[model samples]
Target: MTSPGGAAGTRTDPTGTPHPDPTWGPLYRAGAWSALLFVLLVLVPVVLVVVAPLPPTRGAALLEYIAQHRVVYLTELVSFVGLAVPAMVVFAAVAVALKGVDQSIAAIGGLFGVASEVIALALGSSPQSLHGGLVVLSNAYRAADATDRPALASAAEALIAATNAVSWAGILTAAAILLLSLPMRRASFFGPVLSTLGVLAGAAGIVSEALRPVIGSGYMLYGLLLPIWFAIVGWKLLHVSTARAS
Candidate 1:
């Protein structure tokens, strides 16, 4: 039997396994590159943190650290918040590629993914780290008088607390990954191993975000798994795009 693309030689075979329309080659290629970028963005902050551990979450200490390590702080901030950019692209491409497997699920997952990215971008922080307004607060704290410093410090602390607090953005992100993985498991293109990893990563991500206050460093489990999964997915997408092109 011929595939939906109306060509016997297209990626989809007689068994009815779904494949993306070859017309989506450009988007797939962009997504492939975005996936790699996402992985790099995830890794950079992790490595930076390991090399120069973040300051205590305390307002005064955090402010001082930001002042002293402005470069490092900004780099980490850019990496952390910038994640949404590539993530959005990857999610879009994945949604299009996987739509053939399950249209409704793919669309839902894509919306969740995009929503999470938007939230993260707006908030400018993640469950693991907080940076958004601290730099400006730090400068103000440094320039203020002794009495005024206290208020600025207090404000900074509030920002820190808010940033570290449990967030729906993280939860939605986990859900997106999980939802997308469901279709992936049934789709021949993604296969079982990748889908399994996605399921695990998504589940772990939700749990980590939910229990971050109690688990502390344990959140690293999800953090570590995420990049690994993205890296593999990115490589696969790259191959798919190349094959379609040729």
Candidate 2:
């Protein structure tokens, strides 16, 4: 990898594309702005879930608004438009300029991440398993204070756990594109690096309490660290795009 700056940073492939760009002024500017946009796209919900207190009144109503208002859909739509589309355009332009580069892998990583993330999110919501991990834990506590039987409670807890596990895996996959971008040593490196650590922590956490899952906090802890990473990544990528245009 090139040093942060200076002589060694000049290393480039045999064909002679400068590692830092002969004129990095524009590229660095682009990287900064792109990262900012990424941060905003990712931070809205995280702040709601984190810095802000749980609405306590979370219920079907919230879910209903999420659906009817189409908040998630709109948010995703904007990102797809203003963020992803722009990124692909830049990827193509850069690849053409480099001449010897293949754009396939980067494209695939982004596409696969979209697919896996969607699948994971869907699976987490599916009600197919009545006796899954999440339900089990919820019912367990309920049973302790109420009349629910062990079998029913156990089933629910398992479903809850399974969903939690699957969700984390999906998140890791969704973040895969960001993580894989690491090898590129792109202008936006902070987001992927931090997100990768979160993935590891999440996967390791689920593995830890597989047998006698207590009121767990492993996943909670892991989720806590992601918001900042998102902010920085979005901003960097947005800025990078702008820089390239200039």
Candidate 3:
């Protein structure tokens, strides 16, 4: 049986094992607004651009730059910390909102979204791994004679390979957006046009990330599309009245 005043099949949680809660509707909308602000202010600008800057030079030169500019290193750590909490909340919020319409798709999409953030946070910071590797390599290269060149190069190559492995997180995030957008397309707030854009953004992200090796820095293209998609969704959520959500 359905909870009083709740639409049939609305569950209290994404797992759908418990009773439905009509009250969660407003909470999901509020979470959407919070996520929107995070995308606009933090994720797009600081996490993407600042934390992941273009390498001015490859090999020794790049290492040297990283060693000298400690701020870049520190910023990477800070970005991960700053992004972790909001990212989790936003994705969870998206999950809750999506569940209101399509529970199965929402559950899958939410997992993908969470995986994306978790991978980034898990690998992005650890001084002993990527961050520490950079500093250690830079310092070693600085002190090493010509005879040690080959060893340093090999180590750097290994580290770079490991770094690229994290790109799959982007693919997961794209999948989440694509799945979430499907239900939004049917919603009155998103409609066809904005929902179509959301679909396009997700598709672009998937393609860009998949072809990253071939296209080099082409994955950055999603940066342009995603903000717009996020803004549209966030705006709709922000303006949606509590009564409508309930």
TM-score of every model? 0.93, 0.41, 0.72
Q: All models: lDDT?
A: 0.83, 0.39, 0.62
**Of the candidates numbered 1 and 2, which has the greater TM-score value?**
1
> How close is each model in CA RMSD to the real structure?
2.6, 10.4, 5.9
Candidate 1: minimum summed lDDT over ten consecutive residues — where?
A: 1-10
Tell how far residue 232 is off in model 1, in angstroms.
1.1
Name the lDDT value of residue 26 in candidate 2: 49
Residue-level lDDT of model 1, residues 1-246, one tens digit each, is: 325643333356567776766678888889999999999988888788889966778899888898898888888889989989998988888888787777788899999999999998988886544676899999998898898998998998888888888888888888899889888987776788999999999999999888777888898899888888888878878877887432
lDDT of 1 at 5: 40
Q: Compared with the true structure, what per-residue lDDT tens digits does model 3 show for residues 1-246? A: 343333455544333332313456565566667667656454533454455664543566567667776676556545543454555565676666556566787789888888887876766642112345666787888788989966786777677656654377768877878887887765555577876886888898899777755665565667677767766666665554243423
Order of candidate numbers by lDDT, starting with the best:
1, 3, 2
lDDT of 2 by residue, 32-122 (tens): 5554554454455444446533321122222223334344434433443344333333323222222212235444544544455455444
Model 1, residue pairs in steric clash: none
Query: Candidate 3: worst 10 consecutive residues by lDDT?
Result: 12-21
How high is the lDDT of residue 54 in model 1? 67
TM-score of 2: 0.41
